[model samples]
Target: MQRYRMALALLGLAWAAGMAHAASEMPVPSALVGAWTLERVDNVYPDGRRVELYGPHPQGLWIIDAQGRYMMQMVRAQRSGFAAGDKSKGTPEEYRAASLDSNAHFGRISADDHTMHTHIEQASFPNWNGKDGNSAYTLKGDELSYVVAKPSSGASEGAHGEVVWRRLP
Candidate 1:
């Protein structure tokens, strides 16, 4: 009786492992699976004025795998460097600049037609860690663009954020 119970437990464990592996293989949209380079980031106000969120020239990369996993990072092209040459020794201004100039996150993502859903497991901003977000997007040829309903950048009261990317070759 003891041997039969042990065999049944081992069989159940093997079945559970197989199910877990299958869950990670969830398919992602083909159009969104690739390496993409950031083209620009902007903030558009309610009045029709648009401002560059990350300076005139920004830099970033976003990579999405076929299995719905992704990582993304974006930064201003002209961010100021720390005067101390050591990150831990930066002053208050330096720390604030560093935090405001970059954004990064990674986790599972999925898309359906016009909206992309993100499950951020971790992010540069602690508030976004373990958060889920949905953003509307447009995919035209090699370019993909999305608009954030509410921006993290503390812009003007009614400003919305936009980010554009170009698919890599």
Candidate 2:
């Protein structure tokens, strides 16, 4: 009876070990390459305002290469141009208006199983330069959504900012 029980226990342990190995051998999905559009952004502010930062419809695109480089730009569709026609001559109000309504960053990204981090070499907003932004991402068919650990809203979620991107057809 002791021998029989030992054999069964060893079999169970072997099976569990094999299962773990198979899980680890599974290939990481190939959905991160290519172009994606910023379909929508939801900012769950701690102040109880679930505001749509941009209007109902926003415009943005991101193109990432297999080489790890990526560039993204998004803005309120109709941004007011610097009235002086020379960018250096823009007024403070015009500059502020443009700054508040747009986001653009270009850099390289490092990703693992469920996480990706961006090292912003340069950004439209200078404050982001040299910053590291980490995000948790999920890909389902043509849509990829990322929940980032940033702009802490001090809410239940801790990080209440989520941005969704659709793989461009």
Measured by TM-score, the strongest candidate is 1
TM values, all candidates = 0.81, 0.73
- Please count the clashing residue pairs in each candidate, in the order shown: 0, 0
Q: For model 1, state the Cα shift of residue 119 in Å.
A: 0.7
Model 2 shows how many backbone clashes?
0
lDDT of each: 0.89, 0.76
- RMSD (CA, Å), candidate 1 to true, equals 5.6
Best by lDDT: 1
lDDT of 2 by residue, 107-167 (tens): 8776777778677899887878988777889888899898655542323554376788999
Q: What is the lDDT of residue 166 in candidate 2?
A: 96
Q: The CA-based lDDT of model 1 is what? A: 0.89
Off by over 4 Å in 2: 1-29, 152-159
